[model samples]
Target: MAILATEGLTKRFPRVTALDELTVMAGTGVTGLVGANGAGKSTLIKILLGLLPPTSGRARVLDLDAATHGLEIRRLVGYMPEHDCLPPDVSATEFVVHMAQMSGLPRTAARERAADTLRHVGLHEERYRPIGGYSTGMRQRVKLAQALVHDPRLVFLDEPTNGLDPQGRDEMLALIRRIGTEFGISVLVTSHLLGELERVCDHVIVIDAGRLLRSSAIGDFTQASQAIAVEVEDGLEPLVERLGGLGEAVAVQGRLLTVQVPADADPGRTYDAVRDAVCDLGLNLVRLEQRRGHIEDVFKEPVA
Candidate 1:
């Protein structure tokens, strides 16, 4: 049930290769395409949308070959480019309606869908105002509204939270989650931010300079580790000394200490050691919890 896939995809320019033998798949639910700027994320999206031709390899969207069936694929897919492309003088409602009609909706149905989509994105009464007068967040909503207006089966959202404030970013992410869950539309969202993707995506694909790094479910990417995170209010040094004497490995980060759970030892014993160490030093225990992995851990050098 892959909504989009690429096999041995490679795109080369005169001076650099944008994508290099990258193979990946995205199924239903929200999937994140994560990488830094110039990582070929945008280039991959363009190829998938059939907007750019790859130098070699194959790409398919909604089971249609991107090279041969681009028009058919575009009809089923919605794309929101990273950069601003909306007309300044056009009202959101008018713009969305035009886009829906362009997607083959009847004029009357287009208008109705435009209103509904704009409202769903939280545009409200401001949707009738010219795009020129809108804030960055409002402009973003307008772009999102048009993408969803045609009721596309899948959407390629390229940095939908770009230029947004914290609150706006949260709102946009929530909206994306709803599109996949409530509206039943598949989503492929691209971003340089890893944590945001971890929050909303069911699966994530990581790439660097157009090369595939890893692809897996969110849970797999952030599994629990064999380490315990401990924090205390005071007596940190004494607690560290006491834990070391009790045969524990400890790494301190400010107020938190991460103690590793020995491979052959019981985790309960490790927990007990930490508790007894804190109690022996008369330090107020703030937190004692098992450490969990994070998407950022992928970029770190593995512990030997």
Candidate 2:
């Protein structure tokens, strides 16, 4: 079932059009909403959450019309905004319990859920400290904890990894995957980083300039191409020349060489050609593997 959908959805400000005839659908599991800044990602999220109205078209969430059932939808949807909107003075436990209660949980259940959610997000004694004293990663965890405290069926996480370090980003990504797989909550995560989404998302939807660019399963986006990627420890240029001399279509991408396998040619022959070239040059082979597509490849094609 579609968790959320937009049909010819558009939103315009007096000076700018944030969304332009945008239409897309997201189902179960972790679906990634990928686009650059100013790509109308935030606007689309607002419309889906029933926080903002569209200039044209329709949006539905959890089979409820976003325009008409916004209050009920908000009750069942959790949102973790991209920016740091947490209160500086309150402790994580306090803030999260308050949010849970606001989501309509009773005081006892709210406190209990808040504590469990905080622990699930990796907070312990530190959860009692004022949010202002917490690190960026801890603050992000608090945000995530509140979003899950009420146990919503789906979450709209906007750049949850923003301002996180490399390790922190990895941790956050794991947590997101756990939300979808372990907790059984559907996710619609937004990010400008294609690599991050590629790692955790089951599906990806690409948008550019407020228009749909491409939407497909993560496997479809990263399918293996009829090309091999070669890397050598030394004599990179010489290896390229040797492969080209053998009539191979070779392109250099930084330290890696991408050699295309012709439609009629045998893949084993291409592998042999690469192996022989590296051997003749006495260059140390680093990596020789099939090249796969990436979510970033969507930007390489013209918008359809």
Q: TM-score: which candidate is best? A: 2
Give candidate 2's TM-score: 0.79
Where is model 1 more than 4 Å wrong at Cα?
223-296, 301-304
Candidate lDDT (C-alpha), each: 0.88, 0.89
Best lDDT among the predictions, by candidate number: 2
**Per-residue alpha-carbon lDDT of model 1 for 1-304, expressed as tens digits?**
9999999999998999999999999999999998888999999988888888999999999999998888999999898989999999988889999999999999999999998999899999888889999999999998888889999999999999999998899899999999999999999999987777877899999888999888888876643345888999978888888888888888899889999887566668888999878877788889987654444666552422
lDDT of 2 by residue, 19-99 (tens): 999889999999999999989888888998899989999999999999999999999999999898999999999999999
Q: Model 2 lDDT vs. the true structure?
A: 0.89
Q: Runs in model 2 with CA error above 4 Å?
A: 223-296, 302-304
Alpha carbon deviation, residue 87, candidate 2 (Å): 0.9
TM-score for candidate 1, residues paired by index: 0.78
